[model samples]
Target: MNETLIRWLEEREIADVRSRNLELAKAFAMVVKSTDQVFDLGCGTMSNFRYLDPLLSMNQNWIGVDHDPGMLRRSEPLVPRTRVQLREMNLATGVRTLPQGPGCAFTASAFLDLVSKEWIDQFAAHCKDSPILIAMSTAGQPEWSPIHELDEPIRLRIKSHQNSDHGFGPSLGADAACYLVDQLRHYGCRVIVRETNWILDSRDGTLLSMMIDGIERRVQSVQDPVDAQVWADRRRLELLKAELRLTVRHLDLLSIP
Candidate 1:
């Protein structure tokens, strides 16, 4: 997928995208602070740590797990081992049990969207004992971006196109948070739904390029060669023009069942 485009799109939409996550993290942190342990799953590069770190700044055992070795390496240096621990785990093949003993909170960001439906159910079950689950940017559909009215078609089409991408997992686009909310509630979780609509500005050029590139690649998978080339060229010009803003619809769910 075109990470540039995704990043660009996300940059414009960052405000709405992660606003709830920050809030959720703060709330979850309160619970984490009271517990002996905290967990961050699929801790890709520990980028999610930025959200949870403030809560962990004091003395709490922080553990982050991911299948990606590189992300673990990057995270190890950024987070203190005394306060934080890192592990490798294939999120698709989830853990029947969490690494640290059950605690007040388990946090994940953007990771939930990449997992399959089966994984989510399993996750809900595994995390049942934990007091709170904070999932940020559970990608969903019926995007709630402020500009959803304007880019609904494009966003919808792009999401559809990207579903065919190599790594497109079974995430419920833009609505994972909402779906999880329902599931957690079904599982007896008292879920708190907080949604954010972020306006991404041009600072995220690489992000935009990535999204467009990912889309272009998917479209090219079935499109004519010449047509694909033309679209590619057109996208190039659009990026060159700059000042293009995007709205990212992000949904976050906090559950304490």
Candidate 2:
């Protein structure tokens, strides 16, 4: 499949399985008035908006920021009832440029892991009074059912790769949500953290396969290509046999003033 198509499919799959913290969301909804401005960072194909729009006040004004024009374009049609202004701005260098105020809230999905500690600090400082509900940040390494020997090695390599610069200086990777919580609390904002793990089985074959392929792509350059291929092949076979299960831990964070 084309990489872009794969991303869209993966985003859809994630939306279906995402475990949002409803209590926190409700609180955030209460904090944000119908007239408040909402900012969705790294909005991608608007999965965050599709999930959050119904929870927020109707006719709320929104700004969806992303680095990719293609993603922004695709996101526009996803929420017909909502009023969203899409901007193709890279979050790395542009986060500080976003205006924050009393009647505003910030949101992002599957985005915190890609940013650096400095970036988070800057963002947290700027949006100190604004309610923030960031979702789906990787919490730790994934677990595979019927363990394989190569799992540990591949996981380590993938973790290392994840921490590498992804446009934002060194990425915080699995530590992002934790660090953000600390940062928000430092700024006197009440923070809530919740686990939203993705539990994939045979029923999620396509997502599982794509995840395996994604892992292989990340680890192959650092480890032996043959080993990466072998591991991926075995996982695919297990998927076909209905013996594969995967658990990827993630965190959902909410910050309230």
lDDT (tens digit, per residue) of candidate 2 on 50-124: 777888877688898988887777676776634888988988889878988687899988889988999989998
TM-scores for candidates 1 onward, in order = 0.76, 0.93
In model 1, which regions exceed 4 Å deviation?
A: 1-20, 99-104, 138-157, 161-169, 222-229
lDDT of 1 by residue, 1-257 (tens): 34443444345344433455566667666666454577787776565665566665476776788776865775677787787889887766656666433654677766565655566677777776675555546354333222323244444455664343224355555545666677778888777866654444456566556655655565555533223445445555666776356555666677775
Model 2 CA deviation exceeding 4 Å by range: 1-18, 223-226
Provide the lowest-lDDT 10-residue window in model 1.
141-150
Candidate 1 has an lDDT of 0.59
Cα RMSD, each candidate? 4.7, 2.0
